[model samples]
Target: MPADSQPASREKPSPAAAPAAPGAGLSAVQRALRKLGLVRDIDFALYLPMRYEDETRVVRLSDVRDGEMAQIEVAVTSNEVVFRPRRQLIVTVDDGSDTCQLRFFNFYPSQQKQLAVGARVRVRGEVRGGFLGRTMMHPTVKAAGTELPEALTPVYSTIAGLAQPALRREVRSGLARARLDETLPAASDWQPAWDLRRSLNFLHYPAPDVAMATLEDHSHPAWQRIKAEELLAQQLSQMQARNERAAQRAPVLAREAGKESLAEQLLAVLPFALTGAQRRVGEEIGRDLAREVPMHRLLQGDVGSGKTVVAALAAALCIDAGHQCALMAPTEILASQHFGKLVDWLDPLLRSRGLRVAWLTGSQKKKERDEMSAAVESGEAALVIGTHAVISEKVRFKKLALAIIDEQHRFGVAQRLALRGKADAGLEPHLLMMSATPIPRTLAMSYYADLDVSTLDELPPGRTPVVTKLVADHRRDEVVERIQAQLQQGRQVYWVCPLIEESEAVDLRNATTTRDELADALGEAVGVGLLHSRMPTAEKQSVMAEFSAGRLHVLVSTTVIEVGVDVPNASLMVIEHAERFGLSQLHQLRGRVGRGAAASACVLLYSANEGGRVGEAARARLRAMAETSDGFEIARRDLEIRGPGEFLGARQSGAPLLRFADLATDTHLLDWARELAPRMLAEHPQLAQRHIDRWLGTRAEYLKA
Candidate 1:
């Protein structure tokens, strides 16, 4: 919530605040279900089960497998509670067939109240043969529900203001009213493999496997409908955007690509040759320009893949068109970096050839930002680079022709659209959006399908490969000795941790203590600096400045330094407890090194001392990190490992709201969803099918009427 907003419950709630939709009336605490976008009730018969709780059969003592985790409902026969050494307590109970134990090292009095004499309860625990015979440690007990439905019960994510039973009751009410009739048009002849639409049709709801099965993209008959709606929505949006862009003209850069192309001339003078991929994308932008229609494109490449060079070349083309161009970045540091790169790429030629460039940021003096703003308005500044500060109310462009946005995801659709206001609508600026985090196609089609995509798939020839290794924390001394050897050899290294200070409550590394420890042991001679998001902006900027300028040899930092830091000579990136970071982030940090002629290394230090009860995905990620530096490969594996919701930090990306789909395993389904969706929607535009209408109606927020 925004700081200015009042507490939701305290506000004079409007009638509109009462959910006027299918999920509107969930118990107050059940409101979190809306955030997950997973609860939509059908007629009284079908209910949206949040989770499929498998308690259909109880495990007996004689039949219980050793070390197997299972959920069992049993009648508590007796209480055999005893205290062990070191303030430990052993609470044991029997279900007539077998006995299980709950072990607590420091359990308080309140925890004991959860159990009652001869109470019937359900528990999930790991079974092991201990000195007390078969013992289930730390079992979760609850009063069993009456009238068992003889199937898995759904468990919804709990919200603060809502109670689970109240939500379940209310949803039962709504489901009674949410019966699917013929509101949706018939699904086309085509359908995906799965058909778990019981709730939508008011049929029998899904089983656990069936409920989970709905999570495959375009694999279920329901998805055929859902995916089509997503496709049409995107396709419609793109067509509209294309039509709008068609009315505008590409700025004829003051430099053209041919003999008249100043951009080409500048490129010709560059010390390095452009890669084939770079040249191809440049040509693609050029072609978009030659037409009267404005270009709206995205240029995505890995870190250090020469995306900045591509942007500069595009800027050069815009200049040749005899019009102004605006390049926007999300951060001041990134803006300054881009400005520096542009200056390095264009200045020498401009100094000899006679030209001008302008830089703008909030940090600039009031007079400087205003003066630059005016210069930009008068077309005196050929290229303008800045942060969100560029979007200030006072800033305006003179005949803005090309608008290039860096770190595009950080900005919203409204912000991106607002960039056009700097130019007249009749002559809207062409757009070139860039992203370092490579998004999967389903997400791309769902969110950014309106724009054409140009990817930099190939690396520049002769670029050094970044050797990656995953080291266990048990070998910490050896890794430190190696770091010392590398430091002695005059190479810079970056140490990335998830936190800045050691927290007693959380099991994670902090940069401050790590920096202190490293610098103390290495004796201040190695220049260790600590950086984290909690620091003041100016302080963080200064730390980054030091690290970038080579003043700080060992910078221990948080994920704030995960993206867009270019230090060609820095050869080592040591990620302490790499398992804590997302795969995309780890890959981005690795991209920082191996940019220069020097061979780089990315050392992933995980706490292997912690037994690997961790899932297969974490292990797979470690293996993948050790095996390859290909970001695309890592991204695909990442999607497979963490699932989309978890990979992008759900609250930040909203990728998880795609409740019934998996981006990792649905490549074929997604391709088909992308391909056949338009065809399906074209045939039944009204969404008349029962399943299709239910799916789309459930997700109305993602679509506009």
Candidate 2:
């Protein structure tokens, strides 16, 4: 085989081969490999290391430094079992110039025999300062004359009972037996300098002289090549999905047939004007609705960017065309909020035009739900807004032409597909999925490339910039005083806690406790209400209604109120244990306030250690929330902190799992892949599928959504 070509094989194994079931005859190493989801030789070969341990050369004990990992060969001068504080094995080792102590809190009798006095051994671990000069606690030890690696050792993510040496041996065997063919076409203008085989070889067993920084940073040419290939495979998968969706037929929802259509009339009655971004996105949706093919579009906006209005306009287009429309929210609170807003904004105008609006949620009484169901089935409800209840099997639509899903990421692709299935026979409804979480541009290009995206980048006029403050839990009284001041001014406040009830496992504050504490602090002059997921739907709705009506001065709740419980008069937000929440969640919780023009403020009260310190990641999240109200920036930072897989949710399971690519730093590579993927697929169709197979394996089925 050529240097760039894969090793030759008699026949290629299928990428989608199922793994052997438990109880089947398999070696211990093979079972361990299966546990890591690597049943095939190819899978084992592709299971890259999490990091590398540079054990090619041993360091002198005299040259060891604190806070740095070192591998050294030394003679065990003394070995003893210490039981003063606890039973521990202490082995004092000395090289030619300096000495160190190896302390093991857990050890077997066999290890004791191996660490006999005057025995020569090799140990690798971080050198830390200890009372005995230098110490290496729980260091990996190997007897003298054992085979040592000549290159950087791969350290894989493993489960219990799976030793690193055993795993490495299996991976090495797999690599040796694996035969791969070139997935991408031969070198072209856009191709990287290295080939697939060379890149994998470099990644798995880098040369002894290779700098650790080069491998760790993932900036080496070989790593960059592999990253680009992975990104390109993802791009190709998304492009295929986009093309497949485009091939499907859909209902053509033309504009309302009149000088002033229902949409126009509704817009005319709006108290405020639409932002430029909203208008642009509305036009985009309007174009998609006018088309005969199914529309798969994502409307992403910052929290409170008027996505609801844009969706309402799209619903109007469908309704005006003699069809029903449905909007599904993730939670009952959000569904009720949408129902109320649509009723307030479009009720009079739509009612005058002889159309009706209805809502159905899980919490609705049987009679009420039946009435709504009948209204929907009989075509009496022109616009329906609800939670997942709208997509239940018992509920049917008369002429569902459009489905708008709010907080689309919160729902699975299957739910969206099920909603589309509700359309009339031989017609698929145009789908508009809305997300308040602003997806980073790189993710949108790779993960959501199949859907047409419209961004509502501008906030409406009179929207106040929320002043965010990160306060330690020690200053809880100060935050409570500020809330009292806001309440005294007739403005409501939202106090968000991470937990519904105190958990013995976690030390975070709970909504119930916080509510009672606030009530006690504020006294009878302030009305305090508690809301959480554990509360019944009726009670939750009642508390929310009272809060919205200003009957409650402080509404303490859990993340259940994170998304869509909007109250313009609620100008103060206090989130307890804010560090426990994600950046986007913090942003959304903060969005609850700043909806009004009364100088809104959001106080993030976080717990600190006795030293008044927080975790680095948690501190970064709080700082990001305070630095900017821009959801996109926060989302980008969140992605940097949490990564793409978590930010995009499980729907990304089908896309290629990036081994070397950092979405934040390798965005340029993603851009190149996005630009080249379609062209590469069009020009080299066979190679494109192979490339996708190589990266995604059987996971390609995930992109069908």
Best candidate according to lDDT: 2
Q: What residue runs in model 2 are displaced by over 4 Å at the alpha carbon?
A: 1-35, 58-82, 92-101, 116-120, 127-129, 133-135, 255-260, 347-355, 500-509, 650-657
- Runs off by more than 4 Å, candidate 1: 1-47, 53-153, 179-259, 292-294, 347-355, 439-448, 487-489, 500-510, 520-526, 529-552, 609-617, 646-657, 680-684, 688-705
TM-score of 2: 0.90
lDDT of 1 by residue, 350-404 (tens): 5554446778777777887788888788877878888877767788877788889
Please tell me which predicted candidate would have the highest TM-score against the true structure. 2
lDDT of 2 by residue, 360-424 (tens): 99888999999999989999899999998998999999999999999888887677777888999
Worst 10 residues of 1 by lDDT: 3-12
True lDDT of residue 377, candidate 1: 82
**CA lDDT of every candidate:** 0.65, 0.84
